[model samples]
Target chain A: MGLRRIDVCGLPPPEPLERVVEALTTLESDDALVVVIHREPVLLYSLLARHRFHWETTLRDDGVFEVRIERRP
Target chain B: MTPGPGLSLTQAPPLSVPFRFYLGAPLFALLAALLLVVQGPDALASRWMPEALAVTHLFALGFVTQVMVGSLMQMLPVVAGAPVPRPQLVAALVHVPLALGALLLPTFFLTHWPWTLYAAIGTLGFSLAVFLFAITTSLLRASAGFPTVGGMWLATVSLGFAAGLGLLLAPMHAGLVSVVVGVRHLHPVWGLAGWVGLLVVGVSFQVVPMFQLTPPYPRVVLRFFVPVLFATLIVGSLLDTSPMEPYVWSLLGGEFFAFAALTTYLQQRRRRKTRDPSLGFWRTALLSLAVCSLLGVFRPFVGLGNTARVDTALVILFLMGFAGSLNLGMLLKIVPFLCWFHLQATFLGRGPVPHMGMFLGDRAGRRLLRVHQTALFLLAVSLLWAPAHRLAWSAVAVDAVWLGTLLVLATLRYRRAVRALAAAST
Candidate 1:
């Protein structure tokens, strides 16, 4: 599977959200998108679910959130 | 690999719920400007003048409180993970009485009509009761941790105290009450320091880091500052008749000074290097707060002879310079963000959505900021030279109208985008 990563750390609200949503539009069925962000995007999960995507989030050691998102099988 | 909490985006109320309050706020500001223009220097001559009282309430109740309530309605669910029940209904019940009371109370202040005072008190009392109940319930249920939730709790309790004091004093101010109460001074203290100050501090904890790309507020501040500030206000109010009152004000001043200094330092170290008009507004607000803090701490000791003008200047600096600037700056970010957020949600995966810039450009925001600064400058001048009151009023009128127009234009853009999205879907 292809992996695409985007770092949205230090970016303000809605910009991070916008970048992730934009990346999702181009995401292939076989690919996973890894997003690195400053904080837990609590509002984004519902949007991802609505668009038939499943995401797993982990708090990295460096204090950033790493989210892996892909289409639900 | 854990999923985030199941905080539903659906909890965010409809755009109209907050927009109505946002859009409605500037009209009261315009009314305040008109009152100033008509009364000229007399309106601002003294804190106890009826005209001054009218104008203060116009800004405090009509503009500041209105926007604050709307923001809480939106933020509680989205930021704190607590949903307010029946948001539209609650908004309606709150907004109508609030707007009515804001208008009637100011009119009563100007006219001294006994019935208007009673009616104002009744409507405002009802509105505050509903708001406090709803917000208090939401805060209790909020899953968010300290600084935000805890701060909100203190602020809401403060509002209850402020509103309670105002209701008790309204009749006394109008000569409707026979008993003389010495706690008349506590009302504004609770309203300004307690309700307004605490809420601003609490909201800034989330907003500055999220929007301005600043580091989060210091942990010590997040944990103790709000609670300490609230306690200080309580102590100061209780000791209004005691010699310790001045020391309390000095302590409160020091706390605010610390907050302002920390925020300024954080902004200087902000990760985002891009030019932002909101930063200018915030800087102006912080500077004003610092100045006000110094004045508060020193005035008692130095003994400024003309207390009336100094008090009026302090009021203008706090209400207009600090609170007003912060409100304007936040609206610049929030209105566009909300518009884009809602539109994106509606058009999910349907097509590319318009970015926030399309809704309200940075240029427009900067232009409004310039006008706001000019108005502020004119207000400062008007304090020194009485004739400048006319110019100040004019600038204020333009500032209010310009802000209202920009917000309306942003809404219009949102509507056009919605129409386009619907057409594409069909």
Candidate 2:
């Protein structure tokens, strides 16, 4: 599956966390998800680890956070 | 790279520490409401009345301060990355005595009893000292440099001063230090502004954006606001019954305007589309601040003939409208959220955790909110027109019971869910 991008910027905390969760659940083995948020979702990293998924976070120049996720192979 | 184990869910104090205080607050509020019912408009007469003194200490020390202290204990570890040492010891020492002092100090004021006054001075003074030292040291060790930390720091300072001043003033009733002991304005001002207002504003910096999906508060305000407010409070306290009263008013006027303006702007920018009771409560508080600050600043110019009436209006607006509404609003959010957090963390892999919303449930929370709103409206009206006084007192009594019940039920629901999970696991 192609990558899915979920925008959680400007949304409050649990919303960003929830939107990323929903997006992650919808992705297939080969699919990937990208989350755009205002702050680093430090807790999300642990959550992904719990689900045995992998994520890489990159800080954009604009100060927004972008987290990429996919199932671990 | 492997995902790092950043912090455990257990980083915050065991839910019991905060929960004990949270559960205790409504009980105190209930006591205050019952006291109101007993005294009626007589207590509402003026700031100088014994009834007024009793009610103020009950609400300030017993309810609002308890919640603030409890929340700080919870947040210091999790939010600020500093955990108070020997938290259970801290709780026992702080909570029990505070509750005792709330009852005794107010009794002393109402009854003019020397024993009660002395007991209040002893209990409240000791509890507050322990609270300040434990909290401040823990904060000093805190690694995180969040704005909330600064607020807490100054709040502790304010609390120390307020408590000291309170202890000093206690003797006046006992005929110990005899001269009018006019630091009365300074005492409550520091108590309300330094302790209550600072903590509220400080916690808002973190909570408002996260819980409500609002933008971060301005950096300048976060960095400079609390310190300046603390300074002004100290100066005002020292200038008690002085000619510099006008300058003090100016100092406070500027501060309130800035706070109200920032709070209003940030609230308006909140991303939520639907209505929220917390927001309604906050709006009530902010409006009270805005209107009252204006009135306060120009009181010298505009002759509001009845000092007692004006003082009563300001107290209700500040204590009930601002502090009380904000206290309830935050408690509603924090209680359910803490339940959800603890449950989810506990049962992450073991079993199905209960739905977070099921703890308080939306309908119940909304109903509770309605009760508070109605009570607040009646109380505000009672101040304007004397006839509504009994109605206001009765409504507040109901409101207190209503809030306590909702919170207790929420806690029960949380415990039940956890028990069910354990049953399924085994």
Candidate 1: list runs displaced more than 4 Å: A1-3, A29-31, A49-52, A60-62, B1-5, B178-181
Off by over 4 Å in 2: A1-10, A16-73, B1-10
Question: What C-alpha lDDT, on a 0 to 100 scale, does residue B34 get in candidate 2?
Answer: 83
How displaced is residue B171 in candidate 1, in Å? 2.0
Taking the candidates in order, what DockQ does each have? Answer: 0.50, 0.22
Clashing residue pairs in candidate 2 (N, C-alpha, C atoms within 3 angstroms) = A12-B213
The TM-score of predicted model 2 comes to 0.87
Candidate 1 CAPRI grade:
medium
lDDT of 1 by residue, B1-426 (tens): 686334455576789888989998999999998899989898787887889889999999999899989988988886788877788888998999999999999899888888899899989999999999999878888888889888888999999999998988887877867534445667877888888899989888888888888888988889998999999998898888688897898788888888899999999999878878888889888888888787777767888888788878878888888889998988888899889878766787787788899988899999999999999999988988999998998899899999999989999999999999999988
Worst-scoring 10-residue span by lDDT in model 2 chain B: B1-10
- Candidate lDDT scores, in order, read 0.86, 0.77
RMSD (Å) of each candidate, 1 decimal: 2.0, 3.7
Candidate 1 chain B worst ten-residue window by lDDT: B3-12
Q: Model 2, A1-73: lDDT tens per residue?
A: 7898988887764567656655665678999888888777755664666666777788899999888888878
